[model samples]
Target: MRGIAAAGAYVPRFRLPAEELASAWGTSHASGIRRKAVPAVDEDALTMAVEAAERALSSDAVDRDELTLTAVATTTPPAEEGELLPRLVRALALPKSVETATVGGHTAAGAEALSRALDAEGPALVVVADCPEGDPAEGDHPLGAGAAAFVVDDDPSAPVTGTAWHTEETPGVRFRERGGEEVDSLGVTTYQRNAVREAVTDAVSSLPVDPADVDAAAVHQPDGRFPYRATADLPVSNEAVSAGTVVDRIGDAGAATVPLGLLAALDDADAALDGDAESDANAESDTDAESDADDAGDVENEPNGAGPSIAAFFGGGTAVAVAVEGGLAVEGIADLDGGATIDYVSYLRERGYVVDGEVAGGGAHVSLPNWRRSLDQRYRLVAGVCPECGSVSFPPEGACQSCRSRVEFTEFEAPRTGTVRALTVIGQGGAPPEFAELQQRDGAYAVAIVELDADAGRVRLPAQITDADPGDVAVGDEVRATVRRIYEQEGVPRYGVKFEPTA
Candidate 1:
């Protein structure tokens, strides 16, 4: 049973409800159309891919060097060709000879990239990304941008038992004009559901295990309806669907949604294990709590054979379904699961995050006491009206470029809420030696600007999004800001801003 070894997920912070677009454009799509990821000016598909891949490697049990191949699946790129992999590989410090495969031309190329990984002569990193150009007048103007990645390993948590492909270069769900034009949507609803149902239904039915016995399912994160539509056509129930539905909340992330959704599910399962371990111990006299998770390492070598069977599915519209049975040998994967259990107290000590006060209950997201953590909504945001124009900036910068005048800015807590005004999928290039000099771990990260709701069109700058799928994001959806590390621009550890859904 070549089952799952580990999984990771990611999502952009900003969201704009499709309804908002519908209201603005006075069209049906504006009401509930698809959304895309919103990358900050500093980000690209390469950065977003790196972010997703890092999470996959970090949260899953895996190794860095074990990734011998990198298959980058994207629809857009700064350059059509030219060692793009090197830019990312250099950042993550991956192997020098790692084989690189770039698959573009279509959004569904994500699944194609995964297929490449499976066929790889060796272990590989599979990255899928999408960040359509943001065109205001176009219907897809609010395309959400995002990416998801996975380090291939025959691990137990996220095993890849057997993979099959069903592809057609024929006419797809939507097409565009000659060049740089808005997409032409035809039977959009019918197309989405039909494609998803055909692929998933065929794959599941042909597999050995029955749908009733499958504990979980991770399909494309295009919409909340995808799960219901795909599953209702099969034997699975509503409960069987996982909560990767960040689209309404965050706007659709182009490439990272499916992988992000899978990672989210894996995180959920790991958290559950932690809770059960704690609850069981608390009820007893003392937690015996092993006091040290490392101590049980040698013990874990012996098979417990007592966990549920999990399924993960990713790729563009109507991608193939994958099923991994229990029991498989994946080496690099176990290391990632080790990360999910890291104690907040220990993590802080290791990273040396700012200690403002007593951090007892909350994890790193919390502040010591009155002060905030390195990454927090309050710290990442501050309201300051332009000295010259009187226009406000959510993050409150020193100089007001608007009026070019320094006003006696009164301090006001910035609103954490916002929507995705625009986004793009891009790559990181030309970095100073400090950030660029170091061995790069991953290539991409998801970044976005959140349009503050209270401030009308004001933005919170950039923020890292979590627990979301790029496809699940939509324009006009409600969102809130959070402080997080987008990635290290240089060894200096660049502080960043990101958004997530209010719900």
Candidate 2:
């Protein structure tokens, strides 16, 4: 049985309330969404996908050797061409031999990617990440940013029982120019209603066996209410649909919606099976468990005995559906809170809709050395462990920085977390071109010197502060390193680690 062995999601730790948008524009868009997730100034589809993949791997001890295929789905890809999957594969520290592919250009591709993983004979990871773009006044209300990841295996965490899909060339419902922003049809509302309803109905009916066995259902939600409307006449019930409907909080995270909704349904199914009376606490516990497992390298195996769960996805002219059974417990996997709230102006700055000017700072124009050293500097955060002095070096070198010993050293995953030993906030006039947008969003931004504290040893590292207000940050604040886009050089995004305050 192939299905989701492990599931994880990334909801950017920042929210832009609809009210904030309304306040900014002086006109409300008439929507049920209170707020939507917003990626940090440094975050994009690639970094968010990496985080979600790490979380999924934490729930299941997927050996690197077992993973044969990797699929990534996103409408908002960080880069246009060479290789999207390799970046994620390296970020996950997977072996170089792993085969990979990119499925994109539509939201339905996410489900298609997951379905491909389910069909694979060996272990596979399917990831969907999107940071959607839209016009602030009109298109922004329904677009939210998030990512979801799933690991598929012969014996999955969530086993699959049945599946179906349907596709047709229905052009112009939604379209985007090459290397351009997406634009929906003026008739988008009506077009989506009919397309989603028809596609979901047909896909469900095509399942070989009876489809009514579904106990829970997850359908594509463009907004808070679309799933309810689309599945009204389907075999599933309101209660079943309610379990997976999360757009009320996160908004429509294109390419991530179906996977995230499915995760919510699985969590609900798991809670019901356990008769979990304290759902809120259990969810929090589950989140902690996953995070702890990832931090400590001791992932737990918690199984589920839930009944069938039906997931459906519909995008421009395409739809995919599947019925899964067994191993579907995913509490806390999708829980996201403790996020910093940003105003509408900050949201626009972060999304790059309002840029101050061309960012000046970037990686080395020559990329060979950086590319070769990625495993050490970017992926593993590898540092030297000197045998003689027992001191760790941030960048492993010929000699130990602490004792000046010329002894050989072993390399391992360095502590990517630490405390801010020194901090300074640069005002807009003093900010570099790379950070001018951030300074413009907020009057000032902080730069920190962090002292790393890990099992290996301590090392001081210079970093930028994110996801918090300048005045709120202090010298002793605890923070964790997160991968983020430093800047783009020659049309390529340069990624590095940045620190954010811990909640």
Candidate 3:
């Protein structure tokens, strides 16, 4: 009965149109791909993973306290040897005793992580995030960024019935050397096509269910064309494969491609079932009154009749196929909305390929020890409440701000939704050295002092505003806290809460 209880996905809010890239390099647009999702200056695999995982956990399909394991899969981790799992655990507020593992080194790692989660004895959270980059002039494929997460447990929703794996050494199709920033490909069309067909056919052939019986299929999508091309000789129909094709919109998201496609297919299957039930109800209403009870019962049972779905993931000389049946789709699992389109110059500047000059220096530097100590306050909005005076203090100075009491204070988590109390716009040269890069990439930005309600008292926090223009934000606006990159210092990203307009 173990399967995906809930699923979630994240696509960055900035999109670089295919024409933008084409115009930048004086080349024609890649066929079928319109645009690609681009991460903001502050966004990377870790932040995007946290965003997706939070949405999945919030679906209420699995209890947070019952989660015993968390596995993250990513080909582009923020730091090579850094402690990524720890940061994820802290951000999610998971128990310190929870077992954590990181999986990577190939694009198919997401499917591998999902397989392990379904096999685990207890509930597990699996997250796959990647921001694949390559020399735009070298390959026809457009590299993009995205993330997907799933909660796997014995809840019986979207039950995974069968799994298979196939692997061989097909060198040079796509690879990234150690300490390299871009992915390289051999551009061998015949070799790549043959490898995909052989691996996918072999894995699907080993499954217990007939390939023709699969209602939907999500295949590895390095590009919009490859996925459809790979399924030409398979038993599955083109319609079934098209149900999960997403690369045409968001481009190739590396480890996240297959998982995101699966989420989309699950949503489509659930929607189709809903439509069928509606049709049955409408037909039943036209029947005689005597058959109403029987017709209603049949309609209630219709959602459970959905057939099995297949998802095949292939990359780095490996392919995995999984069969899933009968599940409730989490709402809005594949919606990628509220995005802003940017031109080529902005895209290059944000990607750090068009640095105008040396990075401005002289911003005050905070020690790593101090930053570590404030993680709870910075990431989770944790405040301290004075037991004696009913006053809340941010960053918990160990002394009550109102009563001046020197006793220990109880920790409290502040509400994420708040109202802006004050605001300021930092335009161009007004930005500090730490924020100079951000200001340069993104035009003028706003900083706000937000007021949050606590158990005993209100807490006010000063934070940078995002996802909206500075001129558009004003005092008294409703806002919500979101984790984003604050700045980079000492070759490490500093993550903290940023306010964004709720509307």
Best prediction by lDDT: 3
Better of 1 and 2 by lDDT: 2
* Worst-scoring 10-residue span by lDDT in model 2: 298-307
Which is better, 1 or 3, measured by TM-score?
A: 3
For candidate 3, list the clashing residue pairs, or say none.
158-327
What order do you get sorting by TM-score, best first? 3, 2, 1
> Which stretches in model 3 have alpha-carbon errors above 4 Å?
268-305, 331-334, 453-456
How well does candidate 2 match the true structure in TM-score terms? 0.87
| Per-residue lDDT of model 1, residues 171-236, tens digit only | 445554555534344546776667667766776666666666554455554554565676666776
- Residue 430, candidate 1: Cα error in Å is 22
Q: Write the per-residue lDDT of candidate 2 for residues 107-140, one digit (tens) a residue.
A: 8888878877876778898889997777667777
**TM-score of each model, in listed order:** 0.54, 0.87, 0.91
lDDT of 3 by residue, 439-495 (tens): 888778999999985556889999999878899999999998878888889988888
So what's the TM-score on candidate 1? 0.54
Off by over 4 Å in 1: 1-7, 17-23, 27-37, 59-61, 134-138, 168-170, 176-183, 242-244, 269-318, 325-503
